[model samples]
Target: MRLRRTVLPSPDLLDIALAFGSFGLFTLPVLIRGSGHSPTAAIVVLGLAATVPLSVRRRAPVPVLATVSLVLVGAALADVGFTVFHSNAGPALGIAVLTVADRLPRAVSLRASVAAVGLVTVAEVTAMQVHPATGQNAIQLVLAVPAWLVGYAFHTRRQAERRLRSETQERAREAERRVRAEERVRVSADVHDIVSHTLSMIAVRSGVARMVLEQRPEEALAALSAIETASRGALDELRAVLQSLRDAPGDPLRTAGALAAGPAVERPTLAHLRSLVGNLRDDGYPITLALSEKAGAPPPVEESAYRVVQEALTNVVRHAGRVATSVEVAGDPEGLSISVLNAAPAGGSPGAGPGSGHGLTGMRDRVALYEGTVAAGPCPDGGYAVRVHFPARPVNRTAPADRAEGKRRG
Candidate 1:
């Protein structure tokens, strides 16, 4: 990605200012002192050389250091001291050394610093005839060494900050990948539950309509109508799933609560349990339902209960033929429990046809969403049973006591 440069002060402008400021700080003293401290032509030239090269310090720090160091030595050789130039090169050389250390590798910056100190010490010794370990050499070492050290500190800080930013970005990307994978699993499970049950009923009803079409027109018509109703309902549920997919990110209407909002379809709850049982009875499945009088559960838990029962009954219809099956549901504020029992198939095979497929997997997935558990196995007396239990609260729904009191008042 191309990053656009923001509007800020230019580096070149700042460098130019530093260059001129150093020139004036050094030369102004000579001008202020008049002819009494008049600077020679060589002195003026050497001072200009020391200050002008600072303008390009950021781009070529090492080269600027070399140039300025050369000028310092030349001034020392040509009798340039406190009166003529007044050590203007000290601060200017410090700035250049700092720039080099901050931008370049540690080894390279260290070598440049050593070279600068060596050159300045040699010039001071030759000019003033000072000893090798004198105060002048000590002063030069003190000034140059600290500047490089401070610049290296800044370089280390910048590197640490950049590494931290990169790591944070990588972690965020990994988290997003995990979320998308989970969303895919969730969408697949929902689609499986919605499509599998609806299509199974339609297939059974279609077969019934075909068999009865030649013998009883009325019965055949009823079966065909049932297929039509089932198909339309399936289409509606499928549309709701599709709508949820559209409400994902990158959509203009994708607000904060859009994901939890889901589709506007009426989710099936325990109140529809009776109608579900009635419909299964109409299809000639020998299933009995026993629900508690004061069963209360949250909407999500209720929806999960309804689906668990639906999947259980569908399994009975497919694998057990017309065997006797029983469904029991009981709940209070603390939790809800469900159990479905069925006599094994006449052939004695427990998980025949759709019984051992994704149907059970889908059921377990749904129940687990509510932190529920399911156990399905053959009973000792020759039957199969599925049981589920999940925690719930009765605070949001009507209890049996309240209903009975209302009935008495009425």
Candidate 2:
């Protein structure tokens, strides 16, 4: 029982209807007044020629205007009851002028408008000479001015909208590029941390095993076992990082055709510090750890804190070589704080290992993401120390639930 709404016709169909309607209105009155005597077939044909071309006014505005104008002029000269200012000819020419203004360049449209006004004036004057009643046609000449102005306004608005859409698309593309660049930097830093720490441990343990192999078989075997564990852990962490890159939400094809292997491995946090410290201790580093129970933090803050400690310890083993090290982690209402200090080596100066100089920079960058501060320097007692603090903030635990609700609504 429901009724469907009617859809309107397209522009081309509307133009055809206008052409036929105008021709019928123009010829109807003459036939009525003739009372049994209709106009010649030639006059009806001329009227059809003048109005039918208007159907293509938008496609070829200049040509359609010219054709309509010429037909009106011929009809006026032959005194066949058609003039430039008649209802049919006048409106048809006005439509053509509007179309020309909207579709052509301003300079070309302007010239065409001038030529149209001149031609219509000449045709009207010619008709007036033959029929004095046609003198009132001069008043209808002003209609073209408003039509041209309206069309020009439409053209200007269309250009502005096009430019706005172009600028919007450019800005969106720029933002996407920026996000991709930042992700690259973050992933690079993580890989550096993982590879550097694992390789450093393996190099040290492999050297120990090589030196003690003939003299002490058990100790050498232990060192080799440590190397195997470190390598496996490094591989797992690297796989996790690659999986994250593949599963990133921005562009599905960003890591296209790359294999995403292995189960998801949780990112390291304060809870994983004991295992990290134990691994370093087995490698013969003299280290002490002090940790205080703290309230939960956002995932990003926890990850960054763990990296800060790991990088500090790695630097200790690489630069200070088996030195006495102490790590402290504390949290309060204000923020979380971490400090790592290592005493001066037995030798006057610590021996340098393969260092890329990017560890400390990466540490600082991670802390800065959470608006934290980092300070690293040599103490007065000839010990190196790194200190970091991250401010506390409430975590939005309901974010996942909110996202789920939004998806359901959609």
State each model's C-alpha RMSD to the native: 9.2, 5.4
RMSD to native, candidate 1? 9.2
Report the number of backbone clashes for model 1: 0
Model 2's TM-score against the true structure: 0.76
Q: What is the C-alpha lDDT of each candidate?
A: 0.71, 0.74
Give per-residue CA lDDT, model 1, range 58-161, as digits (tens): 89999999998887776565555422333333576778788888888899998997898689767866766533222233355567788888889987888889
TM-score of every model?
Answer: 0.70, 0.76
Query: For each predicted model, how many residue pairs clash, with residues at least 3 apart or on different chains?
Result: 0, 0
